[model samples]
Target: MTTTTETATHPLEILFQLQDLLLIARKKSEQKDRIPEHLQHVDAAFREISARRAERQERLKAAEARKKALEGEIADVAEKTKKYQGQLPSVKTNREYGALLNEIDGVKREVRAREDEILALEEQIATLKAEQAEVDATFPEEEARFEEQMAGWREEQAILAVDAERAAKRAAELRAGVDKKMLANFDRIAKARGGIAVVKVMMMASHTAACAGCNLRLRPQLLSDVRLSKEMVHCEGCRRILYWDHRADL
Candidate 1:
């Protein structure tokens, strides 16, 4: 009772299935060959190291400022001591001479304290300089490594771009050969089915056949249509375009 329209072969159906396979392959290959996430970690590490270097430089500047301030204090104390010593020869009373000598001793004590502080700041500056040099030496190597990884990623992306373009062109050519109504139906199914618009029926060892897209059992009538391989058919359960896999024996 089946008319010719129901039994006629649809070549575009096979082309649709081939296009879907190509799309899946292209997507998977692009995903796998893309750059790994470690490149971002490298960039973060560089930023952290650069920040630490700036912090050390600021600390060194503060130390230098403290050292300079202490030097000025020491100079002022020395000048005060000299002035007090020169005034002691013109003093007529013992009280004035005693007070000037006391002032000179106090200034000398301050000068000694200031010199001790200067020495401490100098030691801190030296330590900071050594740490900065070590960081500087390591930074260049890290930056170079990141640059190399970025270059590799760019190259890989370029290759994937070419492959994707060729695949798209081939799919377009295949689509152009298909009837507009069939192509529209395929696209609608694909949009609803996560890029798996068509699938070949797969037979299991248990002698049960299933829709490869949804793994549902095929009905007796649907199975007959699939076995005939004359007309394009869809799985009633999953609504996916169905094709026979003669190479399933392989």
Candidate 2:
């Protein structure tokens, strides 16, 4: 069971409204799971397209890095081949000359292999760039379409904004009316207890009343006090103030 802040207009009543309003004012959007299906689809589609575009850009970068590394390898191999070929003229024997020729051939083959890799990377890079360009061309339209399709979500967001503003204004008024010490106590408890300081009593399975916050069985005397609603009644276990909410869902 929950106590709504807007229900009873006393200090407790003000607290109930304030608690609910505080949470409401904090919300900027509906939870993902709670978003309506149509809006979810629109949002998901936009994200998917965006992810695809991002993936393409990332792949292009990786391809460019690989290409650069291969080009460096080719340069190093070419330099080695030049040094080996230069040693040919200074060879003292046919054996040394043949060894130098083999060394040059080996380096040449290595360079060819790296050049082939560079070519492949260049091709892949071009493909990625084309795909990215496609995304760039189409993504704006997709974004516009998503925004158009999410008209309902946009409307809901506007409503939430309005409600949050109203809640904030009302909360300010409620805070002004509350005793400063009580308000301080409420803020302390709410912060310590995940933003819920005022709570309703729950009837347990055995038909005994319990603290909704802590689910601790309330003493008869405490429950009686809660029912009287004369002053703040704190739950023994949770230390959260308890209110007798007749509208509590049993």
Candidate 3:
């Protein structure tokens, strides 16, 4: 670690400042993490409603297509019946007349079946249209609510942005007083370990020092060096920089 030429500030004090910087950084990051989570529900609802609307529209289209097909079939059957009626005058034998009449009756029955199917499809189309109208009527309200929710999220994000900027500025100021080499070590350690670079050495019941970061017992010589605060002291278990509180007994 880089040694500080400044005699006024102790190593422990410098590490404490760095620790405060880390806390500020972590708090700002945590606040940013919550912003996206806050909008998750609103976003999910919007997508789900949109999917349902699309499905309804698709169903409506299918029903309309079925009605058109049935209508076409009914028209063709009607034309065939008219042709069969025209053929009745040309039939010379009683058997031919009877066959023509039977064919016309079968065509009429088919036409009726197709007409009934068309009516059913029309009814289905009307129901779908009504449902679509209801969905459309509520759409504007849902859109407005979604917009308002997004606006609220933006407002919260703006406020959190200001807080994050303030915290970052304070952390930068704290970093300026810290030794360059020590800060670099802390930065490296923090990147590897969840933003924690420094920890206290607590006096354990066994008259030994334990690392607060990992709760592992520290060696006597390592604890002694940490107490002196003359150089960087790292915990053997977690490798975090260790410090000693002057008020704490060993």
Top-scoring candidate (TM-score): 2
Better of 2 and 3 by TM-score: 2
lDDT of 3 by residue, 12-42 (tens): 6667766776677668667766748768988
Tens-digit per-residue lDDT, 1-250, candidate 2: 5555754455687788899988777664333226677567767778988888888888899999988888888888888988887788889999988888999889989988988888888888888888888779978888888888888777877787788788778889878988888899899999999889999888776558998898999988898789776778899998999978755533
lDDT of 2 at 117: 86
What number of clashing residue pairs does each candidate have, in the order they appear? 0, 2, 0
Q: Which stretches of candidate 3 lie over 4 Å from their true place?
A: 1-9, 35-39, 47-141, 150-155, 247-250
Pairs that collide in candidate 1 are none
Alpha-carbon RMSD of each model: 11.2, 7.2, 9.0
Q: For residues 141-177, write the lDDT of model 1, one tens digit per residue.
A: 8778777868877777777777777777777777777
Model 3 poorest ten-residue lDDT run: 1-10
Pitting candidate 1 against candidate 2, the one with the higher lDDT is 2
Q: What TM value does model 2 have?
A: 0.65
Instruction: Sort the candidates on lDDT, descending order.
Output: 3, 2, 1
Per-model TM-score, in order, reads 0.50, 0.65, 0.54
Best by lDDT: 3
